[model samples]
Target: MSTQSERIKERRKELGLTQQQVADPVGVSRVSITQWENDPSVRISGANLARLAKVLKVSTNYILNGGPSRMEEPSGQYHLENNLAAAPAMHGQVPVISWVQAGAFTEVCHVELDPEDTIWLPRPPGASEDCFALRVVGDSMVPRYNPGTLIFVDPEVQPENGDDVVARLTDSSIEEATFKRLILEPGAPKTLMAINPNWPHRFIEINGNCEIIGTVIADMNLRRR
Candidate 1:
């Protein structure tokens, strides 16, 4: 008898779907699909199981039992997975705010100012629902991060030495936020450094005038056509 893992792998291949393609609509990492296909003992949660069923065009009972023979389907109606109403719920939503609005966003934390511009993202482990995203605006961090790159920020993550971070100038006179690599050494003052050496203002001393807003966890680059 075929195991659940074998059934999942066979069905996925039969439908010509890659693991990443399935993971995207389901709001999970591709690693999750790999594990599910290799380990029969790995239990998929109810929500993800339902999502897998829909994407695979099979019934949850067939997935759990390893074949259609284990469970009978109704005479006229199709499987529940075929119904649009049965789609899996989104993992979470991250607000994509402008660079100028980033400063005030970190201050308020959870307030939803605009909903239409938000992006759905799979919540990372230990990341809070308050996490947000920002689009790179300048070439300050060129070579590593280019303009129009989308970066996800987690305010709860502790900014460590050499970590990329979004910082705000605490000087009330400057309302703009900046993105750079943070440098923190024992007994030495903190500073922000840009990746591009050609940028005029490369180093910024974070004396009492700057505040670290959040640590950058992940980024996506959308190539222009």
Candidate 2:
């Protein structure tokens, strides 16, 4: 049986991809990929391994265990088909911005918030081309959106009551953006709510000092096992 390192090197060579090509998509340097391929015991993070598996078009189980090559003609085609069927229908890439960056992002009216830091994600059905993404910060929306969740926001969508949204406080000095449920009623005050019940001060009334940035259309949780 081949070692895990050998499997990674062999599969990469079979796919005609350079170490840098494999590294770029997984957010690592070429040297890191070289280390991973040269040292069997060097541990690769689960998140990076998953990204690498997706880019290499192989299973994580096969990558880690060095099982029978899925590249064998019969199994290769089947594996390729399965990958295609299971893959996300990627419409385009979206920038994954931080809370501080998100505030700056709202100030600039552009489709690409930060082109250099973006991820390819499936576009929501009927979503316009102006959608962007934000990485959840804090435990405010716990069950619905844990920290590190990637949420796709559509500025074109008209936000309704009870819709999840990204909002910015009107004060330009405040750099952090807020992610919460938007509550709008006919006569009551508009408010933002934290979905997590245990969080102290779970609600903030939206007065004239806030602006709705966008409505969250879809989300992708990247937590690794």
Candidate 3:
């Protein structure tokens, strides 16, 4: 019997759908779809698995234990083999907010958004329902992260050593949030390090006045997308 990952890949190809197409409606990144199709150790949650079955136009049972596609047909559907139209994409969207708005992120992660004020993008897998996105605006993180890169932020994840984070200095007058790699050293204060060595403020110590809004879960260069 074919494994679930193989079955997912097989059905995806049989339908001639790109991973991104499948990912969008499934509320995950294209990278996540790739991982699901290739990584045997990666387990698909029940909700996602059901969504995958719908997106792939197959039954969950077929994905779990392949034999024949027993997927339920749409009402008033034709019975022509391999002639089904693509299923409509269905996925949750994450709101993209401004840097200034990100600074206002409280412990509850409450964001008051007007539908017109924010752009919505697909929510990547593992991100909280309240996850948000920001566009990179400076050269501080340059070498690896360029301007115009879109980053997904999840407030639920704890910031750890070397994690990229969005933070605001509560004591400063600046209202915009900042993004940097967090650094933690034994017997030393936590610090945020800018990836670009040439940047003027390359390293800033995380003092009591500093508030980390959220850790960056994923980032993509919009120019390349």
Candidate 4:
């Protein structure tokens, strides 16, 4: 019988899904998956471990006990080994890395974070490393984050019932990123709404098509308090 990790790797390949594909569904990373299969030092949450078991066509007990089992268990649907990583922020200030593509798969480009892009007020320590800062180049996200202002994106933060979020609209031609309010329609369709009365409240229908970069932890330069 295949070992626990071996079984996971085998099942993943059988599904024809990339490491990333599997990782997203399970809220992890492809890199982590690779490490999990190779290192015993890695561990996953019980919930995630169960999900993995389901994907691998194995019982949770099978993984925990590694008891007598068949090596050729059936395969199923697709699957962060991050153990020692820490936040990269500074004292009295947060170090915003740079905005990353939380939605579409665009060409990877490097960004040299500009000091002006950061704001040092009412933010958690090491919060800078939690998000990427993007310069607002247009008015799509006006009345909140204006042009030339910097918005921070934390992909790990979940957008709340109606919190503003950094999202990637399905239409690539639109602004590279937009900050919008999340609107969950339950039975209807998931979408984002623009509250700026000047601009139409755009509804970005979400399904398997759209991507959410992250929730906006803090807004920059809306107005002076």
Per-candidate Cα RMSD to the true structure, in Å, reads 12.2, 13.7, 11.7, 14.9
C-alpha TM-scores of all predictions: 0.57, 0.56, 0.59, 0.44
Better of 2 and 3 by lDDT: 3
lDDT of 3 by residue, 1-225 (tens): 788889899878877788877876666678889998998778665445655776776776677678876575565522223453333234365778889889988643255554333466777876776678999998999888888989999888999999999999988998899999999989988899999999997999877888888999998776454
Q: Model 2's lDDT to the true fold?
A: 0.71
Q: Write the per-residue lDDT of candidate 4 for residues 36-86, one digit (tens) a residue.
A: 777765665433454455445555556545775524543454322345232
Q: Rank the candidates by TM-score, best first.
A: 3, 1, 2, 4
The alpha-carbon deviation from the true structure for residue 4 of candidate 1, after best TM-score superposition, in angstroms, is 44
**Candidate 1 lDDT tens digits, 130-215:** 56778898899998988888888888789999999998887767666789999999998898999899999799887888777789
Candidate 2 Cα misplacement greater than 4 A, ranges: 1-90, 111-117, 223-225
Q: Indicate the worst ten consecutive residues by lDDT in candidate 2.
A: 77-86
Model 4 spans > 4 angstroms off: 1-123, 126-128, 170-175, 222-225
Expressed as tens digits, the lDDT of each residue in 71-182 for candidate 2 is 2233332223323322232342345556776665556544322222345555567665566677787898998888888899887899999999988988557678888899
Return the candidate ranking by lDDT, descending.
3, 1, 2, 4
